[model samples]
Target chain A: MNTVIDTILAHRSVRNFEDRALTREQIETIVRSAQAASTSSFVQAYSIIGVTDQKKKEQLAEVAFNQDYVVNNGHLFVFCADLYRHEIIGEMESVDVLPSIESTEKFMVATIDAALAAQNASIAAESMGLGICYIGGIRNDLTKVSEILGTPNRVIPLFGLVVGYPAKINDKKPRIPLEHIYHENEYNSEHESNVQELQSYNEVVQKYYLERTNGKRSDTWTSQIAKMLEKQSRMYMKGFVEEKGMNKR
Target chain B: MNTVIDTILAHRSVRNFEDRALTREQIETIVRSAQAASTSSFVQAYSIIGVTDQKKKEQLAEVAFNQDYVVNNGHLFVFCADLYRHEIIGEMESVDVLPSIESTEKFMVATIDAALAAQNASIAAESMGLGICYIGGIRNDLTKVSEILGTPNRVIPLFGLVVGYPAKINDKKPRIPLEHIYHENEYNSEHESNVQELQSYNEVVQKYYLERTNGKRSDTWTSQIAKMLEKQSRMYMKGFVEEKGMNKR
Candidate 1:
């Protein structure tokens, strides 16, 4: 197997980070790699805010549901889905091109575009021998996160990524078998038989959490999601995304 | 700067591909990298259909509006946003777990998860010195692409990626300035100034197309998007996604 593939397959989210600051050159390379990712129609509807200020990182940490890693990380980047670029073009050309909920196509494109760019940045960071973790809790309270990031309309903050040298490596989380997800020419229900495989993996996941959390609460993957869903932890995200002028009508 | 950074910074789409077959080991590495990307709650809500069969690739090309590159590429990967795995979990537990439009959170996570995985796969391919081009045309007619790929409900075909050794390296496309997209702490409205910078880069983009097409319809970046948006392309994707039992309801 290729070295990169080995690194990828052995991937783990690194929350603890060495107390070192990332060089500006490092940030530039990661951002450039992000910009290089495929964009939908080259709209490039994404921007990343590199937060280095300690005070700001603390604020961001608070907004990211108080994740300690956010504050202690070497670098914190918040990826935003932006449409203001097109709005500028529209204004210059005297057209009404700003995306709205009616323009669901554009909304989807921008969101996916932002995601692709963020993913590229993540991969690049990993290749650079840095540990990284994504902060999806940025959506836990979108309005507050947006306020903290100073995000504007048509520019919803999707997630934050914390990057640094590894203080430690977390074990790789187990995934449901491919047979459960990959289907042939059409989606065949027969592939559903792989759920038992998932159950087997659940023990692996339980062990992972137990080791990490010292068995305070033995959380299985299913229960984690079930609890998350039961409370609709990030439920405000839909209204929040719209309020940020993403799915406008 | 590292060679990987150089490669990523100079990234460009490669539409015209030469006849080449990707090694099996290459496919395994790339797919494994995709699997390594972060999954939402470790759900791994996605899958890739490696379309190596020429007959199937030809059919896919037809559905994607005859994008010849899809058929000619050494590899065609259909990256799917899958909820099928979760649905099976629901079935096994005798629970109703299909995500609805009201389940906007699920939709968002699944989409982001799948795109992140695809991006990892793309970077891994690039690291191995391969060319990649994403096929958004897969969404031109979601139903057709889904049927062609045998996609299941709650598993939407987000995009296709055509990868292989490049026939030749194309010049890197210039990006919109960081100012145009990146905001400080809040959203800024100085996008008008950014547009001026874009004009010069737009020329670069136009020149790129001209060089590639021998001056055939040298459309600038803005004009290309205008032309693309002129059609109702992907306008029905939202409804189609929902109709496929995705219940983006």
Candidate 2:
């Protein structure tokens, strides 16, 4: 009911952005807001690449599988889980930093740090009456993205944020009921398989797609997920992340 | 510069908490804000378990290597990157979901989703005049934490959040220079190894620790990270996530 919660719940990833560019002030506020997010152990292990050059945007859009919004949004910011800075700092101090960089825990920490910053940026943009979309599809080609951004080893582009004024608004998608996604004191699965939760949500999603796409696809949530997961998708991310020298174990 | 940015930049993880509990309304508002965070697709692939019982908190604190905030906070919420609900939904519809569950991309997505949610929760709590801390140490013994929480397969506790009134305030830690974190156009490492940026931050961190701890530790960020990383920390998370039936590859 609070303004913060209201902002959080009313979120819908906006793809169609107004043609007008965001003012310099807005971008500064957004990025500064991003910096304000809490970092694990104050390591601040993340970086963001702001892309406005049309050609660079086009390349990134293609890298994100031609997600046009990457090219057309008010701005595109690629968030990277970066430990490279830590390495640089260590090198300046003539100290070792790899043991922290190579482990899964630190990798997850950096990943989460980037994510927290991205969300803060998203919320900040939205607070100013802007629309935004998270471009996870950016990971569709990590190497190309790193190449485009001049990212070195020990940095991985976790995801991108496309911020803009809303040209179109998508309907709010239904989330699972609280009972299914929440537990009281311990991990409770008694209701995980409950038909009441599953069947009802399926119906909601079925109607969502039907109405949203003008009946182009009439499928339930379960069916959609099953279809998406039936075949291996993005299986190369492991080796790709390893190639980037992240979480190499 | 706005209220949102101010709230974010002012964020300090408070582990020393006043001995008071969050009201039902407060918890509801905070959790709802968490639920509102963006997810990869509409998967909503995350869950939160709030631990209130003294015994349960004690057990979890021990699991987190005796992080007393887990037991002392107004509330403790364990944020889990959960695919188990998707699995259950898949089962109700008679389909396979492991392929998606086991991939690095999906694993990263779920982890990011939980992090996004947790940060929102943290911000919401802060906005409500509360303090919060993220407990990544929950992963120190993921299996034991899951056991305490009764977590099923495909659901891993990403981290814990301790929310309460601040009993103590830590001085703000200085982050790296904004230029270092915000790159323009491409992945420009042109200044990544700049000793100028490195030395200034080292002094800032060196002074921060020295002043905060009454000169108990006069270490710089580089030296601290170097010392911390020189030895292995949390080497068990990879195997732990795998044991939880996530990212099996």
Candidate 3:
């Protein structure tokens, strides 16, 4: 198999990192690759905040509920779904951008673009022998993250990417079967895998977590989903997004 | 630089593709790499629809406002932000998934997951000497597209990706200067690039489109944003997303 495919397929989230630092050249090249990702309509509605300040990273770690990767990684990249820049560009060119920027479609466009670019960054880091972790925990407190990042209105810190040389690699987790994730021309929920395939996969997942933690964790995939979804999590995200002038039209 | 980095930096949207068919092995490998992308909380909240039926591609092309690439490529893979499988899994396990599935944060999570997977698919295809074009025009009329694809609630067709051997490669467009896109430690709007960097990049982009089209197009970067953001394009997307039972608290 090719190296790119190898890098992609073998990805595992790395939270542990060595104390060594990444060279500036590597950092520049990685972000350059992120900029090279395909953006919708060339809107390029995204930005990256490179966090190397130890104090700031520590604060962010707290904001992410003590996810130490926010502070312990070689670098932290805050990927922003930014419509603020589009507005500035429009103002620079003497046009109103809000007719679109303030709408849900554009918000999603920006979010999706930010995500695509961040994935490119992750892949780029992996190709360079670096390990990466996507830090969605930052969304637990968007207000604190925004204040820390100085993000203005119309800018949402969608997620963070922590990149470094791996100190430890967790056992790879199994995904749901392909037949359950891929369809032909139409949405197919009637597939046997969709309705009846969870039991086997749940066993796989249960064994994975069980073995990963020396049998300390005994829950299956279904139980985890049940616990996580039993109550509203991150309901404030919708409010935060709307407060950013998105979805307000 | 490595081949992976080279392939990434040389990305350009390819609309014209050589009329060719991809092998089953190649298709399987590409989707496998897509599944390798990280999903939030192991939700795996995404699905891919591979459109091989010529007539179906034609109708999707119409849905995407006659983007010929949607029909003219070697493969059209519809990346969907889907939570239906999670619900089924919940049902199979006899747990409630609606409390979280009905929230907006989950929708964004699924959308981000699908986009990450699609980008990986794009990268894997590119590494294999294939071309790709991300067709966001699928959202221009998602309601009809849903009917065409039989997409049920909680399954949004985020975008379509066309992969093939390129018949013609457009000149790669220049991105905004890195200083504009990447912030250090905090958001830096005072940087010279933020307010004053577009002119030079505009020149680069203008020259690119001008030469690529043989002087047929002369618009600058700012002008394109001004034009695209002048009106509310895809305004119906908000309603469609809500109707799909996403983004509703």
Candidate 4:
């Protein structure tokens, strides 16, 4: 209805970017907007790493399965769920806060904080006529990713946000209908009805793929998800998070 | 720099809201903006429960430690990390997907998806001259909250977002300095320098609190967080998430 909502609704991940670098002023504005997001309990348990070094970007691109945008974007921002600063606060205050810091609750807070901030940054960049893509592929190998970033304990790199001028913009993918995703008063647990809704949505998604790929592909959303989930990926995430001294409780 | 960035930077939680309900159009726009956020691998592993029933809102308020805003807002949206739909997809496709759904990586993806969507919703609400607050207090009693929302297995309620016209607007809280929260190329892990930066930030926060409370309170950010973390809260979150059939790996 308005420009802000328009900006939000127009969001599409841009994988290909123009050969242009973002000015420092743009980065500052984006990061400042990120900082303004509502943090859980005001903990602000997140940090952003601006990857400008080409060598470091190359390493991150490798970690992200060689997504060229990871290296070629106007900027690369690695959002980290960080409690290391909180740990430092505990030491300075002489508070035995390790138990709570190690709790899953804190972990959730940090993760949520990072996501909220990154989304804000994304919106801010988009509003400035930039395109952004969230690179979750970095999680393919968190250990190597962390080593590349030189992140400390209690700091987990969640994902990368690559922002730049878009070389191409794809059609927005259809989402599950609002009725299927939004419940009123209480959750609607009618499994049969939900399955029916998905069945219909599956057709819509299939049509989308068919058109997008010129009838070469027609996979339904359900089939895609089921195929993806048939085998476990990132099974070591639990151990890695624990090793980072988070979510240990 | 633009209106969108301006709207994002001006955000502050509004606890005391006008006693007015959101229009259907407003809620739709908000949720649509939410759905526009990036989802990991298009999993879209989240649901939003809109609690408009008075009795349910009252129970949620109780679960949120008697935070009346839970019931008094323009609307309440309980964001859930939902894998139930994916599980249903698996059943329909006759594909075993439980192993991946139960992984910690999937849990993180769901949680991050929910947070990203919620933040978008929050910003959309704010841009429309409304105010929003994220009620992590809902985590105070997850089982009870789930019971109230009638959430099924693999559908964990992460937090609540209350949006409404504001009755009061609090001053925007200061964030950690950009230098501290923003690193260049790699994570700046210089503990001593980081601690010094925080110490400087602590004074700013203390001054803010002192002014806001009319000299009645003057707690530093570090002291506040340290005190909160000194006593573990929501210690059951891990068990609760596990019981919900998530993060098992």
Candidate 5:
């Protein structure tokens, strides 16, 4: 496979990072790649904060459940699903452009625009031989993030991404089989034969955890998810989003 | 700049395509790249339906407001925000995983996941010197898409992407400057100077449209968006999402 395919197919989360800092040029390239992604109606309704401040990084690490890489990574990007930019544009043009909750479709388009742009940056970083990890924990303390970042109303932190040189290479985490996701023309969840095939996958995942952590927890995928969902982590995000002006339909 | 970075940085929409068929290996590699993206809780809540059949592609293009490139492209993919797979997994484990609008966070996560993954595929294809365009018009007729694709409950079509070799290279579209998007700590729309900056952009966009369409209509970015949002395009998406059983908090 070509280098592009290689970078993509061989993708993995890189939490540990080297001490080298990302140069301004590299950061510009990454964000430029992000901006190159298609936006709905050319309304690039998103903003990324390139956080390089040490104290701020430490605070973000705390917010992200003490993920050490947040403080150590060369570039910490907090990607926001921003309606504020467009809102400002509307204000300047003297137009009332706020689509209501009845406009669930517009909301989806804006959110998807932010997400697609973020992934473009991730892919570009990986292709440039940089390691990256997405910090969903940004949502864990959503209200704090908005306050810390001085994000105004109509823009919410969707997620954060930490990018840098890898301190160490890690083994790949196993994903649920391709069949579990890709459907023919319709969604076929009752694939009895695929369910039977998952037995081997359970074993595969069990071995992966054991080998990766050296038998630290020995948790299977099923148990991992069960444990995760059992307790509400960011259940407050609903109110947080509403407070941040992302009132859903 | 390297080829990959150039491919990414110089990215633009290619609304025309040759009739050459894409190889299966190309599609598989792109999908694999997509699958390798960071999914929320490893749920991998997305699916890509690769449309190679001519009749189906034509119908899909029609659904997307007669976007001729979609039907004529080598590949057209419907990217769905899939929750039914996880719901089935929930059932197999005898756990209730019925996602609701009340489960608003999950819905957003799934939608974001789908967008992120689809974007990786788009980037991968682009890096390999392919041209692609995203079709948000799929949301313009969600019920028809669901029916046509045989999508089940909790699976919504977020967007569609058309991929193939470019028939011609289009001029790069101008983006709003970084000063407009990059907020240091919080959103600051106080800089009224952006209006003047946007006037220059309006000129660039107008020239692009005039050159592309032989001056059929004089349009600016604001005019385009205003035209698009003037009608109720996705008027039924809220009720459609509710009908699909995603009644969350």
Candidate 6:
């Protein structure tokens, strides 16, 4: 209904971008908006790494499974769940904070903080007429990504936000029906109704894929999810996170 | 620079809300904007439970340690990291998907998805002249919160988003300096430089609190963070998440 709502609704991941880097002002504005997001208990437990070096971008692109867009975007921002600063605060104040920092609750706070900031950054960039895509592929090899970025312990790079001028805008993908995703007062656990709703949603997704690919690809949402989930990917994530000195509790 | 960015930059948690519930249209619009957020690999692994029942709100307020805003807001939305629907999809398609669904990777994906959507909802509500606050306090007792919400397995309530008209607007909390939070090309790991920046930031924060509380409170940011982190809170989150069939790999 308003400019902000319209901007949020029009969001779509842009993988193809025009060959132009963003201005310093644009990047600052976006990051500033990101900083304005709510932090849990005033604990701003996140950081952003702006990858501008061509060599570093190339390395990140490799870590992201050779996604050229990772390097070719106007700018790449690695959103990291960082508690290292809190560790520093602990040292400065002479407090033993490791017990709480290593707890899973803090990990959730940092992760959520990073995600909320990244979303604000995405919306800010989109408002400036830039297209953004979140590169979750960076997690495919967290160790390598962390090494390349020189991130210290307790700082896990969760994802990358690629912002650039879009070469082409794709049609919006349909989301789950509001009724299916939104529960009133309590969660709707009616199995039969849920299954029926999902079945109808499957048809809608199938049609979208068929139309998008000119009938070359038509798969139901359930089938796609099932197939993807059948293959266990990134099984080492738990160990990796723990090894990074987080979520050890 | 624009309306969207302006709305995001002006964000502040609104706890004192006007005693008026949101219209159905406002809730639908906000939820619609939330759904438009980017999901990883099209796996929409999250759900929103909007609590409207008075009794349910009171129970949630209790779970949130008697934060009356939990019950007094225009709307209370519990953003959940949900994978139960994916499990149901596996059952429908006769595929074993538990291995991947329980992986730390999927857990991160679901949690990020929920946070991104919640941020969008918050911005959308704010854009419409409403106030929003993220209720991380609901996380204090997640099991009881889940029971009250009637959530099934594989659905962990991450946090709540309270939206309403504001009865009072407090001064915005100052964030970390952009330089402190944003690193260039690589992580800025110089301990001395970081400590210096943080020391400077502590002054700004101390001044804000001092002014806001009429000199009654003047604590440095580092001291506040250190004090908060020194206390062990929510030690059962990891086990709770594992018991709920997530991040168990």
Residue A225 in model 4: lDDT: 94
Native RMSD of candidate 1 (Å): 2.9
Residues B1-249, candidate 5: write the lDDT tens digits: 466667678788888888887898888777887888998767666777777667777777788899898788867888988776555456566665553323667767888999989988887888777898999888878888887787877788888888999999887777766655555544564546556666676787788888888999678876666545545567677678778765245
TM-score of only chain B in every candidate structure:
0.88, 0.95, 0.94, 0.98, 0.90, 0.98
Candidate 2 structure quality by residue, lDDT tens digits, A136-248: 88888888888888899999998889999999998887777777677889777776355677788889889888999999988888877777666677788888887777777
Model 2 TM-score on a 0 to 1 scale: 0.95
TM-score of each candidate? 0.89, 0.95, 0.96, 0.99, 0.92, 0.99
As a TM-score, model 1 comes out at 0.89
Q: A96-171 in candidate 4: lDDT tens per residue?
A: 9899989999999999999999999999999999999999999999999899989999999999999999999988
Better of 1 and 3 by DockQ: 3
**Structure candidate 4, residue pairs in collision:** none
- Runs of candidate 6 with Cα error greater than 4 angstroms are none
Model 1 bad stretches (over 4 Å)? A99-102, A203-220, B94-102, B203-218, B245-249
> Could you give candidate 3's per-residue lDDT for residues A175-238 as a string of tens digits?
8878767788877866575556777878888888888899999888877877777767898888
DockQ leader:
4
Compute the lDDT of residue B101 as modeled in candidate 1. Answer: 24
Question: Which clashing pairs does model 1 show?
Answer: A101-A248, A150-B185, A150-B186, A185-B150, A186-B150, B101-B247, B101-B248, B101-B249, B102-B249
RMSD of each: 2.9, 2.0, 1.7, 0.8, 2.5, 0.8
Error of 6 at A85 (Å): 0.7
* Candidate 6 C-alpha lDDT tens digits along A75-192: 9999999999899899999999999998888999999999999999999999999999999999999999988999999999999999999998988999999989999988987788
Interface root-mean-square deviation, each candidate: 2.9, 1.8, 1.5, 0.7, 2.6, 0.8
Give the DockQ-based CAPRI class for model 6: high
Expressed as tens digits, the lDDT of each residue in B1-249 for candidate 3 is: 677788889898999999997888888888999999989988888999999988889999998889888998899999999988777766766777786897878988999999999999999999999999999999888988888888888899999999999999887788988888899988976535565667777888899889888999998898898889997798888888888888887
The whole-model C-alpha lDDT of candidate 4 against the native structure comes to: 0.94
Worst 10 residues of 5 chain B by lDDT: B95-104
Candidate order, lDDT descending: 4, 6, 3, 2, 5, 1
Cα lDDT, all candidates: 0.74, 0.83, 0.88, 0.94, 0.75, 0.94
Task: Encode model 1's per-residue lDDT on B6-54: one tens digit a residue.
Answer: 6557677888777998887787777777888897666677778888777
What is the lDDT, from 0 to 100, of the residue A197 in candidate 2? Answer: 74
